[model samples]
Target chain A: MQYIHPKAIKVWRIHGMISAAISFVLFLVLMLLGLFLFRWLLYLAAGFLVIGLVDFLIFVSVIPILRWRFFRYRINETHVVIRDGIWFVKHTVIPMARIQFVEAEQGPLLRAYRLAKLKISTATSTHHIPALSIGQAQKLRDRLAAFIQASDVDV
Target chain B: MKRAHPLSIFAGFFKELKQLLLPIIIGALFGIRHDDGMSEWFALFGIGICLFFAVIEWWRTRYQVLEDQLYVKIGTIFMKERFIRFERIQSLHLSTNPFLKLFGLVRLEVHTAGGEDKAEFALPAVKRDEALRLQERIGGSNRSSQEDLLAVLDRSENSERVYRLRGGELVLAALTSSGARVIFLGLFTLLGQIGELWDRVSFITPLRREFHRVIGVPLLEAAAGVAAVLLIFWLLSSAIAFVKMYRFTLTVREKDWVIRRGFFEQTEQIVPFKRVQAVKIRENWLKQSFGYASVYLDVAGGQAGDGASEVLLYPLIRKERVAEFLAAIRSPFPWAVPTAAVSIRAFYWKIIKYVVPLAVLATILSLWVPYGAWSWLLVAASMALSWLGYRDASFAVDGDRVALGRREFSKETILTERKRLQFLSCRVSPVQKRLKLMTVQSGLIAGNNGYSFRICDLPLAEGRRLYEWYITAYTRSARRELQRVDGESSYSL
Candidate 1:
């Protein structure tokens, strides 16, 4: 079993920061409305500011660190096991025989950081290994693909 | 590999008309309500256009069975095409409703293992002999061998009777089933609509008005009226269920399971042994009390006609006799039923999840409401229910099979083979982690919604072990089956 790349913490923090930015903009709009339109709505503006602060502290700062600390995955001869989450930890196991396909996806932010996400698909659902280095994602995908192919060949 | 029977055009037209029926009725209701002639005429015009298009679709549609695939092309403007491999075809169902039976034709519904929302392809109406030929062709080598086995079984002196729901048992089953509630709700809605449309002469509106007039009290009279209506609806629904589930019989053959059911429209569903994905045993409140249960099978890519779900194994069986029923069905998994109890601490969790907040809210409500004591009763009942729920929850794994048991108002135990599981997941909340607990959820590939089951608040370590064991066993069995299939497919190639 191994943890995902250390950079996943940074990626998660970046994701949280983006959410915080959106919330901050929303707070600004509410504050403007409170100042210019309705005085009673100033209470709403204050609540919005508090929520934004909490979002930054929890989602951007503390949560990602906890997630990175706990997240782990392992692949064996028969199945792939994934364990992750901060509030609700999940452990998912997909049998090698059930692996329908595997792919590596690089988003703009991930591409900028030279990271890729590996998605393993089965008959019903897809699981992801987030924030792997581009090369690592490619290598892992190839290895899993090879295992699936070899298993199929044996069958 | 030919055009369907000429009667298909009539079937296709009626099928399209059936879909249009709802909207047309709704439009007519609005027209009647508003006293508008234009809307009614518009609905009529819409029906005319739909009929015209349906005829066009029937004329253009064509299907052919090629070497390895059944190809179907339909529609003109939409121009849809489907190419389904023969091996992927899971079941070929031959069904004849009254309309089709009149012409000695049956609808051939072809289903595949792709798990789509709709059937892979349906030939609306085909001759019985032609449907049999198509079924044989699509099935190929396996069908012939299975037919030979069936022949042998037929020649045997005595054929085993697997399970049968007699008339009395079926009535009991229907009374306990959700079918009664569903029917009641459906009819109630229909009556409500009619009442709305014809407020002056309506049956319900006048009865309701008379009740209000006679009682002069709104709430009390309303309650009495509802009770009366519900009683009537229950009886009506029971009759409907009796008709729908009459003569339900499940028989075992050498290589298949045959489910014969229905009174007015006798339907025969044949599921080959290899196609069976999962089995379930369910008991509602009444059924549980009577020690009776219903069993359902998840057959891969199988579809039941008239939009009903997969038919039950017998609709009624003694709870203690479930093992015999499973054995009679020739389930492949080991027979031992070893249960792993959910942690006792789950009681507290259930209380926190269901009872505590509701109780708090009820207490607050008691401060304002005149009948404050009633709130206490509700809170007490909820607390008792939560405690009962904790006592009933358990999960077990025996060899290649997993059984998840849970109770809300009803107790349901779903038994599925490891290889049938399409997905399995284990979740541990922060609270659960502190309690050393987790929840395991699983889904099968059989139903349109993908029948899923969950076992909550199990030991985290045990949950992980179950996940590992399930995946490993599932993969090993799947590989063995695949190897055998691969060898046979190679020979064909």
Candidate 2:
């Protein structure tokens, strides 16, 4: 098993911060609306603001580090195994013969960090290995395509 | 290379009419209710458009049987052409409805191994002899004569009556089946439509009032009426099942297996042995005790009644004779072997996973309802069911066949050939990891829908063995076949 790209922590942190900022803006709007609508809602707005701060602190500061540490994947001749998730950890094994295709994608943020995501698609489900170096993603894609071609023969 | 039967124009008209039936009926109803001439004109315009398109479609559609493939050119404007290789055709069927029969024509339906709905190419109306010839060509091309001859010789000398379900047996099968429950639900929806019509029609109001007055207690009478209607519907559904599966017979011919069944609509499904994906034996609670089970063939893209994926090999038979029946069918998949039952710890795990949370939710829900204690019976029943399910679950991987027996008021033993499986995987939940258990999920290509089977809470060692068995056995067979072909020096024209 290999861990995802180290820059995943920073990527996840930025994602979490962006969502947290949106929540904070929503909270500020709610507080301002409460001032015009009702007095009790003002206290509710204050409570929401406090909850948002705590949520942001945990999501941006704590979860990304844990997730980056835990996410791992392995590719073998016959199957691809992915292990991830925080509380109820999920382990998925997709047979190589079943994979329809493999794709490498890069969002603007990921491209900025020289990272790409590898998606392995099968008939039933698709599994993704997030935050891998572009070179590794391309190699993985080629290897998987070769595996599929080799497996499809004679069966 | 030829055009479809000339009468296909009418077939196309009827096909289009079936799609527009509901809208046309609604349009007519609105026209009548509003006393408006506009709706009638709109409907006339719609019908004209449908007829014009149907004729154009009939004119545009053309099918040709090339040396290696079936080519279809359809669509007047787009002019789309599709070529289906003979090797990829899983099933070729010739069917006739009353309209087609009047013109001595049959619809030739070609289904491919690709289970997409659009994968089917139907030549709406073709001469019966031409369709039969095409069926022979496709079936013959799917497997060479030499290989089929070898397999046919391996069986018993008699290629006579393979299996036939008795009328009593068919009736028993229908009586015990739970399929009528779905039919009953469908009927309820249909009745709801009628109820809406009853509400809308003013003439029925007085009749309803009179009926309620005569019934004394209207509510209880209505409930009784519903119960009576349901009983009648159930009987009707059973009769339909009987008609649909009447004289269900499997005959082993020289070249392929022939399945003949149906009462109102006699259907003959000819399946080449090579195209079969799996053989499944199912036993309901009653049937299990009676030692009777039903057998179905998972032929890739085989179209059965209502577009179902499997063709019934035998509607009902003694479980003890399943091995004999399978052998008679010359199915490549081996007979099932009873494997170890699911782990006992899984009993507790299932209880925790399903029962506990459901019980909590039910209890909280009962608080809002007037009579909540009755919900405890449901919780108890569910817990007992899960325990029974855990106790009954079993799996085995023997040679080329992987058999999974699961219980849900019945036992379904699925025996799939390793070569036919689309995907296989084993997973472990955190709780299962602690308990040294795993669940294996496997998918098979069967029709347009996703067909998957799962075996939960097996010992980790057994799960690993199953995985390795699949990988090694599948690859070894592939390599051996390749080597055999290479060694044969396949020099062909």
Candidate 3:
């Protein structure tokens, strides 16, 4: 099993931070509205703030754990496999021969780390594995292309 | 040879202008009646818009073929550049209205078996003789090109033959197919409107009141009345079949299948030999009684719309004639060959599998709501239906050909070559794992329709066998080409 790059945690953290900020602002507005509308409702606003904090903490903690748990990739002479989930694990195996195209994408956060996400698309569906070092992504792409050409030759 | 009428543009312009006329007239009326200058201005604006469109159409409407490709350049500001290669071209269609016929011209549409978005290239106003000459030249060149390619490839398979349907057969075929249902639906709507009008006019008011008072009928009597109404409906539907399918005909010419039908607006479609992906022979319970079967070609790039088959090769034919038709077309598959019937395990699995889901839903619904017993009845009906479907399902492998038969409301048997499969997958679900079974889905590259066939619940060994056959067939087909390029290892990049 190949571990997803640690830099993937940074991408997830960026996503989580955006979500947290939105929720935090909403919480602040609701609290202010409750204080103006009803004295008793301020207690409900406090409870909501506590729940938001807990959710933010969970989101912050889970990203790194998920990055550690997930493994994806292509093996020589075989399909590309992405194994994920802490429980009720999912393993998606897409044959290289079926791959129509390979796209390497870099979002803003991933660009900061110089990491790219490799997306493999078949005729029917697409799968993505994010935060790979540039060198690793290139090597994987070369191997995938080689496998695809070999299979096409055998077609 | 019929050229698309020079006046055809005016007809189109008039049609478009007529569509816009409603808003224009409404605005004009509003302006005149309400004495509003703004409405008058809006009406003038509409006229300006219509004239602008007419001018644009006049400029960009002309089409001419150059060399090996048909080019159709249309649109004004957002210009469309369409090219249809002569080799990729399947058929050139000529259609004309009475006005176009008067002008000795017809609309020419070139169809290719490719992307749905880019399949048709149309020439709206071509002379009839020129269009015919173009079709002949393209068709002739296409044949010779294939012959040359075959010689180079060293394959001497006989060229495909085209089939045509006779007028009587075409009518019969259309009548037996879903065309009958469409006619019935139309008539039913008409009758419903008449009935509503009759009720409004107080003509049937006294009769309805009398009938209601006389309706102290028993439960069984009411059930019998319902059955009688259903029987009358069925008779009405069959009557519609006779009227609509009055003059249907199908024809085969060389390597093309032609179907011409319609009571009012006649439609003709040609299906080329190469475009047919699979031939589906279907049967239904009623068809068995009538000694008739429906044949459909799974032709690429045709879409069924409303109630019409996009490409109607042969609407309805006797089962015995299927073999002769197949032989005439040089269809690669064996004609109506018997295949292995699905195991009784198929029946049991289908029933039990459906029952479990229904049972779960029934338990929940019964626990939380009324009419719980009815939910149990629903489960029973579903299980029965699934059992019937499973019993009707079967598949066969005859040499290089695979035939799959699936029966639901209608029975469909699809015949395809192993090499045509774009991809094959063997899936073992958790339930299938427990049962030592697997499902094998075979996909053909069918443009926008995507993967065509999904076969499920085969024994693991059988699924593996099918998968191996697919891989072997594909590899064998390409082996010679690969061997020729043996030393060129740099192709991987």
**Residue-level lDDT tens digits of model 1 in B1-493:** 3778778877877777877865665454334444555766776787787777767766777898788888898765888888888877765666667888898888777765544646767888888777767766776834533343233223342446656787689889878776335544754654575345335423456677788789878556545655665665566567667877888877777766677777756666665556566666777666777888888776554454433445466688888888986786786442334377667788888788878988888888889865454567557867876776666667678766677677655666767666567567899888888888778877665544345567777777777778777766646566666556544211011
lDDT of 2 at A41: 72
By DockQ rank, best first, the candidates go 1, 2, 3
State the lDDT of candidate 3 residue by residue for B270-296, as single tens digits: 555665667778775456456678766
| Per-candidate interface DockQ score | 0.41, 0.27, 0.16
Model 1: what is its DockQ? 0.41
Between the candidate structures 2 and 3, which one is better when assessed by TM-score? 2
Could you tell me which 10 consecutive residues in candidate 2 chain B have the lowest summed lDDT?
B484-493
Q: Give the range where candidate 3 chain B is weakest over 10 consecutive residues by summed lDDT.
A: B146-155
RMSDs, each prediction?
5.5, 6.6, 9.4
Residue B482 local lDDT, model 1: 51
Look at candidate 1 and tell me the lDDT of residue B11: 81
Q: Whole-model lDDT for model 2 versus the true structure? A: 0.70
Location of the lowest summed lDDT over 10 successive residues in candidate 1 chain A: A146-155
